[model samples]
Target: MQKVFFISDHHFGHKNIIDFESRPFKEVDEMTTEMIAKWNSVVGENDKVFHLGDFSFLNKEKTKAIVDKLNGYKILILGNHDRGRSRSWWLDVGFNEVSEYPIIYNNFFFLSHEPMYMNKHMPFVNVHGHIHGQKYEGKNYFNVCVEHWDYTPLTFEQIRDSVVVSEEQ
Candidate 1:
């Protein structure tokens, strides 16, 4: 069966990201290569990936090249750093879809590029990125940023399971 995955804050070709996020890699090339490998390891060509933005700081061609090298059908939720580009530009670079706002998935999960304020009364779990390494305490909020998730794409099932476990507790 095909799977759906979520990840964010790749910031490919952004050397400053290493210092900004305290990422382990020494350079942009190394970071990008490792992230690509990790993504391909779990994401098959047929899988669907929801990338919650800050995808790259490279030129259009370089960004397209990175996108082409990755596996899965990709969708993008634009983040703060993802501005200054048109939706058509993102689509042309390989994103199956691009959105400027939050999306509701499966009628229960809210997908956003940045973590939105949500509570149990909201009726939908918020799955978001940004805020990098900070911990979010709510049972209905899930962070999928690369820094928080070891730079690997997380399956919807994984996020759901965590929600289940949190609720049970």
Candidate 2:
């Protein structure tokens, strides 16, 4: 069966990301290669992936090249850096869908590129990215940034299990 996954802040082709995130790679190429390997390892071609944003910082050709190599039916929730690019550009680069705002998935999971603050009384869990290595204090918010997730895509089951475990604590 096909699987669903979440990931963000890839920052592909961005050399500064290595220093910014303290990523283990020594160079952009190393980071890109490793991230691609990690992603393909966990994500099959038939799977669906929600890329929360900041997907890349490369030119159109280079960005499309990277996207084409990844495994998954990719959906992009546009992040801050994704601005200035047209929705059609993202789609042409291999995203199955491009969204500019938070979207509710499965009726309970709220997906966005940045964390949306909702009160404890809110009904949905905020699944977001953009904070990189930082922690989100909200009980119902889950960060899916590549920095936090070891450059791998997270499955819906994994996120749900984490929430369940947190609730039981």
Candidate 3:
């Protein structure tokens, strides 16, 4: 069956990311290789992956190359750094869809690159990524940054089971 996955803050080809996130890699190349492997391990060709941004620091050609190797029908939610390219550019690079802003999924999960404000009174759970090692202090926020997930994409079931939906809280 085709599954839905979520991940973000890949920072592919960003040399500083190794040290910034304390990633267990000697260099960007190693990081890229291993991350791609991990991503492919859990995601199938038919799976859908929602990447929440800060995808890469490499040039267009290089970025596209990496994206091409990833599994899944990719969709990107533009993070802060992803603003360097246009939505069409991201599409040309391999993403099936690119969103400039947050997207609502299943009428309850709010997906974004950066965490949005959510409270007990709200009707949505914010699933986001941007802060590498830090996360919001609430059940309504779910962080999918690679740092927190062993550099692997998370399935929709995993996310739903971990978060308390607004109505349930």
Per-residue CA lDDT of model 3 for 1-169, tens digit only, reads: 9999999999998998899889999988999999999999999999999999999988889999999999999999999999988999999988999999999998989999999989778988899999989989877899999999999999999999887453266
lDDT of 2: 0.93
Q: Which stretches of candidate 3 lie over 4 Å from their true place?
A: 164-169
For candidate 2, lDDT tens digit of each residue in 1-169? 9999999999999999899889999999999999999999999999999999999889889899999999999999999999889899999888889998888999999999988987999988999999999978866899999999889999999999998888788
Model 3, residue pairs in steric clash: none
- lDDT ranking, high to low: 3, 2, 1
| Runs of candidate 1 exceeding 4 Å displacement | none
**Candidate 1 vs 3: which has more lDDT:** 3
User: Model 2 Cα displacement at 119 (Å)?
Assistant: 0.6
Against the reference, the lDDT scores of all candidates come to 0.92, 0.93, 0.93
What lDDT score is found at residue 145 in candidate 2?
Answer: 93
Off by over 4 Å in 2: none
- TM-score versus the correct structure, for each prediction: 0.97, 0.98, 0.96
